[model samples]
Target: MSRLALPTVIALALALSACATSNPDVIGRHEAQRMSQVLDATVLSSRPVVVEGNQSGVGAVAGGVVGAISGGSVGGRREGQVAGVLGAVAGAVIGNAIERSTTRESAVEILLQLRNGERRSVVQAQGSEQFAPGEAVILVTTGGKTRVMRAPPVTAAPPAPAASH
Candidate 1:
């Protein structure tokens, strides 16, 4: 056989071998393997959180000075000190409220705990009812959400190193 023909035949044989060598035991978890059934579930809940205060440079300094002066006037020096503290606390609360009002909280995350102890979370709109933690939802690992099957495990050899530029 010609040298060129030999290389072509060898290349075809290698391709055939690679195809035949794929793992028989490994299978699509979603389509072929089937859902093992959810044995148990747990619903995830979000904790109510108070937002931190954001005091702006000019506002914080000005508020502090005014609060201090007002507090000082009623009870002399000691009263002024107390007033300053009260003023700072009030200002901080107001500042935090303003910040929170501007930035609304995002959707709550729902977690599903399987009997097998596997857990997954889905973000749902705020106030929306979510799947109870123990609810049975088919858990199929895939390349993307909603896709049923996962790609087969790669068994190809590592790619050759690139040539230096």
Candidate 2:
């Protein structure tokens, strides 16, 4: 058991580290940059929301390996092989669950009415903005995903470059 402690801890840490970088609504690198559809909408409703964590099946596999090695070491050669198999199964299950539970994210649900008389609801992570009912907000959608953000302040555009003399 003592010999297994370090490897077990390392495996568990790696599994958890994979969960720490998860973002529920991050645009991918290959996606077009800032090519978002800007929609004007009024918030019909807003509420706090939770985005469930994603599971990528890493936990179960790791758990199974650890379990197998630990289990197999406890008995004769045949028992060890059987133990390894059982360990792998148990590891996979636990690893997957751990990955999901640890990666859960916080979000907000916003109900909006588009200017064209359409209603839509979007749930996004509450990174820096909050929403309120009846508030005018901006919906920025890109690559089929949308984000709710504060409306850009209305301002006059900078004068176009002066014509050359």
Candidate 3:
């Protein structure tokens, strides 16, 4: 394989792996301008958790192509053919593993209690906001996805002035 081809294949794999995200801070384009249900709750407990990675075939395909080309350039014609097949298989497995590991996310599992004494558990990718036991938070749900965020302090509204006749 040409030196340039290897780098291009690697760059494509990296770009594809970066496409998956479960971060609470990131809102998808489709979610914008949509109304969400908000519920008040208090954090009962917070714990660290791991969000599993995804398996998309793009990685395997990319790796196989790169490996075949690279291995095909090795040894005599017959030997190169055998090596190419083996390299493609090995490369595919390694690439899939890389994709999975790169996409894994560090997250948190939160147990919360609503004002009505109802309890809910949520696991989300760790974001800028952190939850602690006894901390007040709001659960915002949009399109069936929920995110927990710190709630603003309650403030009493000022009285309105009398209206002119």
By TM-score, is 1 or 3 better? Answer: 3
Candidates in order have lDDT scores of 0.42, 0.72, 0.88
lDDT of 1 at 28: 43
Cα misplacement distance, residue 27 of candidate 3 (Å): 1.3
**Model 1 alpha-carbon miss at residue 111, Å:** 6.3
> How much does candidate 2 score in TM-score?
0.76
- Please provide, for model 2 over 8-66, each residue's C-alpha lDDT reduced to its tens digit, 9 standing for 90 to 100: 75467466655453233455675555667889999998888787876665665666666
Deviating ranges (above 4 Å) for candidate 1: 1-82, 100-104, 108-119, 124-165
- Among the numbered candidates, top lDDT falls to 3
**Which candidate wins on TM-score?**
3
Residue-level lDDT of model 1, residues 40-137, one tens digit each, is 34454333333332333333343344444444455667776787688666644543444334333334455666557776554433432334433444
Off by over 4 Å in 3: 157-165
Residue 12 lDDT in candidate 2: 74
Rank by TM-score (best first): 3, 2, 1
Rank by lDDT (best first): 3, 2, 1
Worst 10 residues of 3 by lDDT: 1-10
